[model samples]
Target: MRANVDFEDLHFERRPYDPQVAYAQAKTANSLFSVEATRRWQDHGIVTNTVNPGGVATGLQRNFTTAQKESLDAAEAAGVFTYKSIEQGAATTLVAAVAPEFAHTGGHYLDDGREAYPVPDDASLADHPHGVKRWALERAGALRLWEVSTALLTA
Candidate 1:
């Protein structure tokens, strides 16, 4: 029942499948990967960052469960996010890729074309709509995720 970026139950082998929990875990993993990758490879000119393009009405959402769609609708209604066009969503990625400000910068999460504000790990989406949670940037968690992922790949 302990969701949210757990290494031991990473694949949900020990818990029921909850779409929201799975999505959250995946996002956390992405953030951790960026942090660890930057820490381990920045010296070699490699930069890694996580980007949240806000919500885009894309075909990918076709697979969304009813609960997922409802959650997104609620978030939108609460002003946590507004759906963006594909172009709008891609803009942030372009900024991360080519913006001089982000050049050589890594281990940061970008939202809406700039670095997202940092929020406490327990911060609610309603409180920090576009913020990056502290848990996502924790170095120890990032390192552990890196090691676990590497082991998975090698195994």
Candidate 2:
């Protein structure tokens, strides 16, 4: 969502979209999107939560460059990243989709089938926090992104 803001404010020519950055930010926005959804629909028994279905060995890697694949493979070898099977990756999603536990923590971010803490701005953390960033939870930004996306869809 904020990607649109960056693209709009900076213009595509001035700030060409970085896929990785946009993707991370988009995931952040997704958490906020859930937050906004929870706020708006909680009264109707809708529980909206974010799930970090940990890395899966999906065809997503097809887009990676050979060098990127090498780096990822290295990370996997070093126990830094583990690409789960599709079934493993889908576990959390299935939980969030049907788990009664999520009904109470509607706005929480889940990882490994548990709610995770909000990660700070620091990018060098070794633990690789599996939670939403504070920026993604900002109510104003959520509402703004929702409005902008809605406008685009309507237009």
Candidate 3:
């Protein structure tokens, strides 16, 4: 059976590192993984895709302290920022999982129930060509790491 997953929804919001940075890296890894996995598993009838649900005020947001939380909440309430509830947050994943429209073997990012683009950082945009090449190299490195780790455990 085919499965559709969104990596952003699985983010660890409370990590010590910057949340945006972490999410960006995870999103990159996820896109690369989906592309590589589909290529490797297509013969077995497997398909994979990705989604990015902007910001949702689920339990994940509880990681913020009182002051930070208040600021986020105010921004969200003012309509200046878009923050979905937990149920709303799950909508993209649900659509991806069962929607025939997204059956194609590709990746997508969703925000507010529609197809959306990732908000690229200024640095990333400036290094677009270099970023793409680096991402390709990183994917190869990740595959090697996976191989070595698996081999060590299964040897």
Winning model by TM-score: 1
lDDT of 1 by residue, 30-72 (tens): 9899999999999999998998887788775776789789988
RMSD of each: 2.2, 3.2, 8.3
Which candidate leads in lDDT?
Answer: 1
Per-prediction backbone clash count: 0, 0, 0
lDDT of 2 by residue, 60-142 (tens): 56766677789879988998888888888888888888887886558777887777776665543247546555666778877
Candidate 1 global TM-score:
0.88
* Candidate-wise lDDT, in order: 0.84, 0.70, 0.53
Kindly give the stretch of ten consecutive residues in candidate 2 with the minimal lDDT sum.
1-10
What is residue 103's positional error in candidate 1, in angstroms?
A: 0.9
Give the alpha carbon lDDT tens digit for every residue of 1-155 in model 3.
01112233334454445444454566666655665666667677786766656577666655556766787678768775667667877887887777786676544444345554443333343233222323422446446434544666799
Model 2 misplaced stretches (Cα beyond 4 Å): 1-18, 123-125
Candidate order by lDDT, decreasing, is 1, 2, 3
Candidate 3 backbone overlaps, count: 0
Clashes of 2: 0
